[model samples]
Target chain A: MHPRLTLALTLIEAVAILAYAISGFIEARKRRLDAVGTFLVGFATAFGGGTVRDVLLEHRPFYWVEHQTYVIVLFVASLFAPFVLRTLSRLFSERALLVADAIGLGLFSISGTSIALEAGMPAFTATLMGVATGVFGGLIRDVLCNVVPLILRDSRPYATCAFAGCWLYLLLDHFDVDSVYSLIIATAFILIARLVTFKLNVRLPH
Target chain B: MHPRLTLALTLIEAVAILAYAISGFIEARKRRLDAVGTFLVGFATAFGGGTVRDVLLEHRPFYWVEHQTYVIVLFVASLFAPFVLRTLSRLFSERALLVADAIGLGLFSISGTSIALEAGMPAFTATLMGVATGVFGGLIRDVLCNVVPLILRDSRPYATCAFAGCWLYLLLDHFDVDSVYSLIIATAFILIARLVTFKLNVRLPH
Candidate 1:
């Protein structure tokens, strides 16, 4: 891996984790779960998809297990979430949660697709895995919270955004596009698509 | 694996999957999910735990993916679930579902523990993985149906039953008990524990 590209990927992962954790925190608060429940949901939202992906691919040393420091950081942050959330309730609005989740979705889609490609999986399977790696975390989170999963019920283009972005990444890679360029374009596409869909209230038929 | 042991394990696997799928079908009917939804929930309940176990153990080709025949079998069965459930509803009462689930829980607990041991995981980790393999499918089923997971909420000996059985299996193995004998003893322990708990209406305080 190019040093510069590795650095970029790492940055995206960090940001995505933070974004997803915040969204999970907000959802946990809405349900009035205790500290343990809040932390569990947040952890699941941030890492469940990748964990599943690694498992399916037979990868060892799961991301969270490999980076124990990240788990420690998340734990410390979760401990203070309730107090921080109470103070910043206005700024951390429902829209904010959607935006954070969208950002995570975009970053994860690119990362997952790239990893699957590197693993030498077939294109269709790689794309499906990429979408699964992007959306399964949120799916797990919603299920843990005992709600109809948003991806299943909401007409908004959630998994669709990830699917589109992943396919774009795969297509660009096939066309001999530079890795960094493809990553940026794919990620931005998903983020923007999600935001626009939300703003315009665009929905698929129920 | 010994030929007899392997045969026994395969039979248990078949029975456990069927039992869990039936439980899942009942839950889907209770929620009035359509055919697609019914199949999705049933698949999750039947396969979710083993999927998690295989992933954590870095096993490849996921059990269902490897055995596409099982997927087809389950799909065909799920298609007829609503009709069969309607006719069998009175005979296959809620109590029957519990019993069936308990049987699955016991079988999965032993299978997971044995597999983990074969994979050379530490004893404690193997034990925990065993319990996870026993209970996670049902947990996924409950979550998808927008209910608090039974293992997490139900006061009865749910996960506890699996945990106890797994430990029993591990201890018997340590004592050089015959593999077949140990598996049967452990599985029976879990099945009996769960049935007795339900019969006595035993529950842990919330």
Candidate 2:
């Protein structure tokens, strides 16, 4: 909770939100949704997971509500969704977007798990909370887009990676490791594992 | 609230939950999901709307969490889903199900609007909250079933009915009417309107 670490986490969260929003924008456009629908889908993709986590933990003043700046940014971005989408695609490859999303998944999962544990949830429940935080945004986006959630259908081990990462964070915390290092290590573990699995086409067995 | 009125509202809510859960059961069975998946979907349908309302209003210990019996009932129902489905179909026609669902929509919408108003939200936001609570359970069900939400795709006057009903309740409350009477009037208005519109094939023009 040092000032520098807190600042770093906030920056990473912003990036993650942006990454998730881009996917929402793409899907909304594909569905030919209007500006309002586009903005809503984008907002949900960016904030849905955290919102769900806060709700389950009975936390108040939702992350988006507290960080009104994020809502404003998304609103403005949504106004010129086409232009924003073009600019992002031009600046970053699909691979880069995937990497950013993976980092976001890692950070969100660990944070959610940590918060649940602090709320006195058992380890199993906390780990599930972490996974929910990591994946619920995309799940909601797909629902809005009228498709099966990719996480539910895809065999790329997305939630599994989050599950592992959450357990790692919990273990480190249990051993009284410095939280800053534990957070970074667990996040990196998820990020690397996600990318590696996606590349190798590793899948969960049906 | 009078004890009798409180009991009436609770009973209405239970019926609403059961109706919503039935829809989930049908969808999950159609998808051929396992017992666990069926239970999860049923639980979501039964509670998704109220849960979303609670989250938005920052209400704690979610309705389902507070009413553990609901969870137990849904779990047991899920275990005998096939049998329940058969029994239900035999006992009630499709039209009967629609009637029950419409009544549920009315009750949930009015209650949600009333709750939001109690929490100090503006009229417009409270109305939206009501519509959300009325329709979200089915929305989640359709999403989990990998289809566009019926509310989004159907031209039927589903959410519109909820919207108008919420306004009616709000107006009555603003006029200082007794809540018990207002609740009954608004819920009946929605129920009758929904059934009539469905019968007449009312469609919102795109």
Instruction: Please tell me which predicted candidate would have the highest TM-score against the true structure.
Output: 2
| Model 2 lDDT per residue over B131-163, tens place | 999899989888787877889989999999999
Can you give the lDDT of residue B183 in candidate 1? 87
Instruction: Write candidate 2's Cα lDDT for A1-206 as tens digits.
Output: 78998899888888888888888888999999999989999989888998888878887878888889989998999999999999988999999999999998998899889888888776766886787888889889988888766765465688889989999999999999998889899999999999999999886532
For every candidate structure, what is the RMSD over all alpha carbons to the true structure, in angstroms?
6.9, 7.0
For model 1, residues B1-206, the per-residue Cα lDDT tens digits are 77987788787778778888888888877776655456667888998998889878876666676566666677677668767677667667777766777889998888889989999999999989999998899898888888878789778878888898999999999999988889889999999999998899898888
lDDT of 1 by residue, A74-176 (tens): 7888888887667656667767666767878998878888887888676766776787788888788898887877665555667778878998998999999
Model 1: how far residue A68 lies from native, Å: 4.9
Q: What is the lDDT of residue A206 in candidate 1?
A: 31
DockQ of each: 0.16, 0.14
Q: DockQ winner among the candidates?
A: 1
Per-model TM values vs. the true structure? 0.59, 0.60
Model 1 TM-score on a 0 to 1 scale: 0.59
